[model samples]
Target: MTRSQALTLKSLAIEAYQPGQFEKDLTRAEAARRIQMLRDEIALADSF
Candidate 1:
């Protein structure tokens, strides 16, 4: 993943309350998918 993507993923993980060390071997696409998933989770939780 690019530095920006990694940072965004980390931020989203924290916001979703799922913070942790991520695998370094993740592909860019995988990182993007995870970031979007995290955003969705955070949005869903906030909608409650």
Candidate 2:
């Protein structure tokens, strides 16, 4: 993931643990999907 995407993911994670730091919300499945997407993105980039 790029810097921005990583930041968003981090914010989501913080919300998961702390539950109020971020305004935007994601369900458990949504968060899982986004995390997987980032993993895929990073893996693909590293393959270059």
Candidate 3:
């Protein structure tokens, strides 16, 4: 994965562990889904 993608995934994983720190109410599965969506968005973005 690209540095940006890795960074994004890392950030998401951190949030998944401490979501309340960001005032976000996300479950682990939801956080994982969000990460997948971020990856998909990055893929689509790179297609441009």
Candidate 4:
């Protein structure tokens, strides 16, 4: 993944409280997917 993607993924992971869940060598698509998933999870958590 690109540096920006990696940083965004890291930030999302940290926000979702799953900082260790991401892989270091993910593809750009996978990173984007994971970031979206994390954002969804955070939103779900906030709704409770």
For model 4, how does the per-residue alpha-carbon lDDT over 1-48 read when each residue is reduced to its tens digit? Answer: 889989888998988889985789999898889988998999999999
Count clashing residue pairs per candidate.
0, 0, 0, 0
lDDT of 2 by residue, 1-48 (tens): 355544677765454453343234666556567766656666666799
lDDT of 3 by residue, 3-32 (tens): 454455667556445333322455566555
Candidate ranking (TM-score, best to worst): 1, 4, 2, 3
Order candidates by lDDT, high to low.
4, 1, 2, 3
Minimal lDDT window, size 10, model 3: 15-24
Model 1 lDDT per residue over 1-48, tens place: 999989898888877778763556789999988988888888888999
TM-score of each: 0.83, 0.53, 0.48, 0.82
What residue pairs are clashing in model 4?
A: none
Once superposed on the true structure, which residue ranges of model 2 sit more than 4 Å away at CA?
Answer: 1-8, 11-23
Model 3 vs. true fold: TM? 0.48
Q: Which candidate ranks first by TM-score, i.e. highest?
A: 1
Candidate 2, 48: how far from true, in Å? 0.7
When 1 and 2 are scored with TM-score, the better candidate is 1
Worst 10 residues of 2 by lDDT: 15-24
Number of the candidate with higher TM-score, 1 or 3: 1
List candidate 3 stretches off by more than 4 Å.
Answer: 1-23
